[model samples]
Structure formats: C-alpha cells, structure tokens
Target: MKKLPLKIVLLFTVLFASSNLFAQDFQGKAYYVSKTTMDMDEWGGRDMSPERKKQMMERMKSFLEKEYVLTFSQVESIYKEDEKLEAPGAGRGFRMGGSMTGGPKYKNVKTKEVIQDQEFFGKQFLIKDELKTIEWKMGTETKLIGQYTAFKATATVPVDRFDWRSMRRSNSDDEKKEKKKADKDSVKSTNTDITKSDDPLSEIEVPKTIDVVAWYTPQIPVNQGPDNYWGLPGLILEVNADRTTILCTKIVLNPSDKETIEQPKKGEVVTQAEYTEIITKKMQEMREMYGGRNRGRRGH
Candidate 1:
C-alpha cells in the first residue's frame, strides 16, 4: 500500500474537524437594541395642550428605547428584556402604560411552539401557543448589519387586536358619544356613504395588517429571531414592525458558558388570543371607571 502525501493527510484531518464542529449543536447569545418613534402628530387635534403633548412625547421616548438579550440554540431560543436598574424616583406609570412588548419569550423552532411570560396590570400570564405563520416574501436586497451580511425579507402579518396601536386607537368617552349621535342620525338619513357606524370600534379603522421587514443572515443557520419573528431560512438580525425596530448588536457563538433555555411556567397558562381578550375587557372596564369619575367631578 502506498502512503498518502503528508499534506493530503493533514488536509483530511482538518476537514474532519471542521465537519465535526458544524455537526455539533450551535449555541449563541445575541444582544439587541430596540427603538420606536412616537407619532406626536397623531395627537395634533386632540384635547391635549401643546405643552402636555411635548411632555408626553418626551416620556414616551424612555419606553420606546430598550435593550434585549436572546439566547438560542439551533432548535430553541429564549428572548427577554435585559434588566436595568430604574433611575431613582423615576415614575413607573409611564413605563407601565407605554407598551406591552417586554416579556420572556421562549420558542421551539422544530416543534413550532411558543411560550411567553407576559405581565399586564400587575397580573402575570403564561401565553402558550403555536408559533405564528408569516408568509415572508424574500427580497434580493441585502445590507450589512454589523459584521453580518443580511438579506431582506418582507411579510404582512395581522395586527394583534390588543397591540399598542389598537389600544391607542380605542375611543375616549367624548369620541364614543359623538359616534353614537352620528350613528343615530345616520339611521334617519339614507346616505349609504355617511361612514357612521354603530360600533365605535368599527369607526376606528386600525390597519388590519402590519408590514414586517427583516434582515436575516444565513451564516447563523438558526430559525429564530426577536419577538415572534421566525421561520426564515436564516437567523434574523434586524426587524422593523409596527413603528419599532429591533436590531442585533452583538452575537457570541458557542460560548463556553451555557445558560438553560427553559419555558416559563410561573404565570397562568393562556393562549395569545385569550390574553388579548382579557386585555380588551380590562381596558373597557378602565374606561368606564374613568368616565364615571369624570362625570362625578363635573356634577360636583
């Protein structure tokens, strides 16, 4: 038997090692920063004074900017907000009311299961359900985000009924009363195009679908991303949806230290749809309570 050349033997050994490394489970930690822009113009004709609007916008900035950490393996991932110490004497009201995005989200890419630990109005809920299906249209556009070359993908996803945008569009007492009057008068006038509806919620034309734009890198080879985004051929490095952008800032692959990726089992188990219903009912109750208080104050 003839012995192979030394260089060929060395090349074969290196190839074997590389293949083994690729075959092993890939674990990584990705750091993300999310930012959202507030639409101050949305309140342009509202009852708020300009000074009040300015103050509200300033307060909203704090809630819009946040940092998150995502721990992921090839088949499972966990996404959660990076905890930060609150500034001394910082009011919690605005932070609590501004958005419902912060939560511990766990997803299994292989099984298509998602479990989220959500907190709303001092109550905790464990949202367990299948992963949402997004029909993403892959685009040829590519951009470099940090060190990775990411390909762009777009998808149209239905807006959650309890999303911040929908909550913001909820009718105030004055608006509801005006809508009711218009609807009653519309019955008398046979103008089909009057655009008056008995349901105040119907009057608020919230966009039924939200456009999602994501930049993903095939180098990662993980079917995972921030929030509810997944199912792409590559790992999503950046996502733009619903007026907010979440971008991956750093990624550490196959770190020596490994953290457990376990689903949250603490809160009451509920589906995402059920949680939305709970939020809607709670908001209605809150509106009624506030409206009653305002009426009482005027009566005095």
Candidate 2:
C-alpha cells in the first residue's frame, strides 16, 4: 500500500470499513496541529554517569549551538469538495513537549515534538478506537463525552510508508539500494530547482500534517468521514481528543448568494518535517564535534 496523503485521508475513511458501510453517510476532515509531548523515558536525558552526562552536555551544547527552536508551519492540503479554498482557516493544537518516555532500548533520542494533520467535523467524532472492538456481536459503551452518546470502536493501522526513514529500514537490502538510487536520481534532477534565495527560510520545505482532535454534533448525519476513520458512517467533528481542535466555532447552514465563507491563509509559520530534520542533523553534528573535542582533551 502507498503512503496516504495528508489531505487524501478520505480514501482511507472507507478503505478498511466493514460491509455495512452503505448504511453510514459522513465525511471526514483534516487539520494542521501544533502539539507537544514530553519525554518521560529514562534515556531522554543527558544525565547517566557524571562522565557520560558531562560528555552528553557538551554534545547538547554543540547541537543547540545552531540555535534550534520549534516554529509552526503549514503542511498537506484538505479538500472535501475536491476544490481548493484560499485558506481553510485555523484551529488549536495540543502541546506535547518533554512528556514522553524513552528507554535504553530506544536508541539515543531527544525531547521532540510531533503533530498530525487531521481533523473531523460533522455529526460525530471518534472518541476511542480499540483493537478488534468493531465485532458485530460485542463491544463496550460509555457516556464520558458529555451529553452525546458514545461507544467503543477499534481500528488497526497497517505498517506501510514511503518516507526516507521507512525506506532506509526496509527488510529488502536490494530494495534499500534501489530506493537510495531513486532518491539520488530525484535529488540530482531537482538540485537545480533549489533556487538560491536571499532568505534562509525560503529554502525550507514544510510537512503537511497537523495532529487535531475535533468535536461534532451527533444529531447530524452519520457517515465515517474523510480521512482514516470513515468506518463510523458519520461526519468526524473532532480528532486527537485533547491534542487539537476544529469545532464549528461557527457554521452557517444556509444564506443568500451574497453570503461567503472565505478560507483562512494566515498564522504561525513552520514545518514539522523540516524542523525535525534540522534538529536531527544539528544533533548528529554536535555529537561528532563534541566527541572529537573530548578525544583531543584525553590526548592532552
């Protein structure tokens, strides 16, 4: 399976649905998110042994020496009607900074942030998706989502992606070589397109996904919506639960021909993919530089 596009998640809303989907009728939506999670894992810190911690601090200083900081940017496109909106508007995102856990098992890591680019708005928003919870025979229920009715459903995501990291970790060594060759070929073809710009930010590219959680009015038609969770057969009004939001905020059902709902095209500017890349590269360079300096000191 090919990697799904940030805006084309609608295809997935139905791809894995059960046979009874004909009864449902909802559309899904997507959004950009500015979420942060903390690193709670033991390996996420620079304090191990004093000597080790000291060495790590030196490495950190080198990486941060580039003055890396998280900035917001737009990624991916969303289209429910298949046409473009000047600016779809904006929403709130959750913060996930250093609140995650890392273990020695997980290689050297950093306190990082991630955002997903998907939101829902319609009649119902998915509250929880458990594994194999959709069996027609059995499932649990809960009303924790306020006055609206809610139930438990499960959806499984398969392992499939075409990103640089995914390609590098593929099991087929031949496939790996092919992918590298392909990337080199692509880079060579487009290297000239890397126009020389007076501004450093001009050369940067952004990722198109935001981690969002939306709320919906269950009274509306039910149809599994746009992106990956179309199995429910109701418009997805919210996503990520507490991470990001895309509430109706305000919706006008019908108005005169003069009425208009202009899209939004403004806000904090940054790209998660680019941000991750820059930070990772800086970290790697810092490790090398710090290690080199430490070696020189030992030799002295």
Candidate 1 Cα misplacement greater than 4 A, ranges:
1-21, 44-55, 89-101, 165-205, 294-300
Off by over 4 Å in 2: 1-144, 158-218, 222-231, 235-283
Q: What does candidate 1's lDDT look like per residue over 182-244, in tens digits? A: 757755554434233423344344568889899987767677999889988667999999788
Local lDDT at 30 for model 2: 24
Clashing pairs in 1: none
| Model 2 worst lDDT run, 10 consecutive residues | 101-110
Name the lDDT of candidate 2: 0.29
lDDT of 2 by residue, 1-300 (tens): 898664235333333352333222222222222222222122334345667555554443321211111111111112222212322321113211112211011000011222222121111111121222121211233233433333333333332121111112122566546656654554445332221221122212223332333333333334322223333433343334222222222222222332221222232223534434444665455455654554454446
TM-score of each: 0.76, 0.27
